[model samples]
Target: MTAPGNQAVTMNSQGTAMSAGPQPAASAGSLRSALRLWRLLRVRDAGRSDPQRLTGVLAVVAFAVTTAVLLLVLGGFGAFQQRAEAGGPYSDEGFYVVLAGTASVLLLVPLITLGGAAARLSMARRDERLAALRLAGATTSQVSVMTVLDATVQALAGAFIGTAGVFALIPLVLPVTFQNRPFTYAELVPEWWVFALTVTGVALVSMLSAGASLRKVAITPLGVAARHTPNPLHWSRVVPLVLFAACFAVLVHYGLAGIVVLVAVLAGGFALLNLLGPWVMSLVGRLSARRARSVGTLIAARRIIDDPRGAWRSVGGVALCTFIAGLTAAAAMFDSVGSDDPIVADLSTGGLLTLTIAGLLAAVSTGVMQAGGIIDQRTQYRALHLAGTDLTVMHAARLRQTAIPLLAAVLIATAAALVFMLPALGFGLLSSVPLLIQFLLSVVAVCLLVLAGNLASARVVRTVLA
Candidate 1:
């Protein structure tokens, strides 16, 4: 209100000052500070939009509910010991250790892989930024360390959290008083050396996982032009395909017997998802176009099918984790009925039920991510709207794309179970209350995952369309 002349003069002076100054240095410094702050913020936001966190929480809860699972594993070992003392048929300490050791190793590897995989995925998403650092004269080692630090920190945090949970639950899981017999809590505590080794292992795993993504950053073309472009994974297809073929062949040759076959199957499944997901998506995309009755439905379907490989590895890994947990639970139920030991039977059944439920919750993360990806592709849906497509039909089509792969995964898990456990526990799988509960719970889990994914996607679309 004072004077238009004064305002004009002030604006001109500021414009001239900004133009005349050495601006690049200031701009670069400001950007560097901002980027640093953003990374710190991201590190702090661990598990905020994460599926792994959800899964871990559910796993811990399962552990809490089925304290008998822990007791049973230990008790089973003790039973083996007692039988050996009495010269019973199932009295082999070496056998118990072999079984327990194998299970423990299987559990440890995937968990370690999870730490690395999460880091790699995050780094992949931020590849452009990393490439910039490389172009700015950053050494490969420096860039790798900087990019992987976030993952290392997260892995350390997870390890600490897990260790804390164990310590906290020890007393609750193993009570001091049982039938008036005083028990020492020291026995319940995890050995200090073992706990220390575990934390170290977790940290190392996280670092290694994050380190894997550095190859893309260090090797990719760098500089200003690299900004805002998709990071190229030159051999992503070939390497994964080869691994998939090799692993699958090994697994099949092994005939799905014992833990070795199980491990092979898992590795093969992961590789296959990585290799074949893109091809599946392409096929789905083509089919969707041919089946399109309405414009919106066609577009949504095509969009989902076109990117099947986009998040396939993550989804596959999540599905694999759930499958293993579910199978373990189902096996425990079988053990419950067949075992001569009453305590083993009771604990196995309880653990089986709890783990099955927990596995479902863990799977929700991947489902949510799939839904999120569809929501992000809103421009395609909007274009369909312009072409006179129905929104509801489009939404349903998107959901169908997600459901197809999950259905396949479920079938594979079921088949693995039939082949592996059926021979050991005859007729247990046919009619068992625990198995029924586990299957029902898995269904509930999948429904919940779908609902979550849909809701998340819908919310994204609404916001963008608005």
Candidate 2:
């Protein structure tokens, strides 16, 4: 019916048309596949912007710092030991290293973890990003879990890095040899179990420290911003303080208390700062507000009352740091005043008082630094002023609020000494004053350092506020 050439051309044209028509559908299918891949990758990207990032970053940095400190401590001790065996002039130098290193490590870890947790909570309370998580259907528990997880991951990584770094750096700092040959640095190669335990312990502490803040998130008024408004300090601080006071009283009366008694007393004092410090600030805040001629003081007072927890938290850090420094100073003083000295012999005591004070103070210093964030929250305070608070009154409220924690910490340190020494040493308590005095001076020095840090923080905040 048709010529062969025409038929062939017709068939070829039909095939070309069919292929072209399906090309668009194929391309669209490919596009959809690409889009699916992107969607799948989104989960991975989501974690980067999480509130937990702060915790993670902190953990990493802390790990590095801890590792460095550990290395310095170990290396110093090892070299001291080596030098002593060589009949060097500093034969007893190894003792200092052991005392300092053990004290530094044992005291530092818990304090750092506690402080880090408190600071992180403060940040979360202030940050809108955390609020956004809530809006996105994340429950308080989910947020808290994520935070802990991030801390855990970072802590684990950090511990590993820190241990390895310490092992590596120790050799550089102090070349300890064995039998005229360098000791093989094995077994000390970043113990996985140590990293696991350290990181886990730190994360748990941090999470627990954040408990109050997390509760706030869970119970925050619906539709209100998750930003904490001024409120009474949480009651967790009060009960513990009461219990501590009771234990301390018992210790004072008994004069034969053990380590358990000392721990209870110290913990109670720490609790009192959180509980009583906030109440004191709230009272001052109210008084200041009443006397205000303008709205600024009232607003500031309101802010102080509204966020008593924050103030208490910051004080905790200060207290902890002061306590640690005081302890360190006390120990050094004791060492300086040799036990065999006639004056020391007349005192009728051993190393227990000095060591106890140092250890307790170290714990207190950790708590105080956690509360340092309050000083960093000046902008938020400024916002209160802008919202109609008088600057002078507000500043007073802030100052008073801050003073409560510092004072509490100092008092607690004194109380800790009283409770522990009175029981353990009896009449020997009188002899403790000289060492306690040294501790007080040390605390003052550390407070000066904290104030300097605060001033620097204020300057930065002022610039940012401006």
* Best model per TM-score: 1
- Candidate 2 lDDT by residue in tens digits, 443-466: 665555544433333332233234
Error of 2 at 138 (Å): 7.3
Which pairs clash in the backbone of model 1?
Answer: 116-209
Residue lDDT tens for model 1, 82-171: 444655344343444344443433333334323433333344344544455445444444455455565555555656666666555555
lDDT of 2: 0.45
Error of 2 at 396 (Å): 9.0
lDDT of 1: 0.46
Worst 10 residues of 1 by lDDT: 2-11
The superposed Cα distance between candidate 2 and the true structure at residue 342, in angstroms, equals 14
Worst 10 residues of 2 by lDDT: 3-12
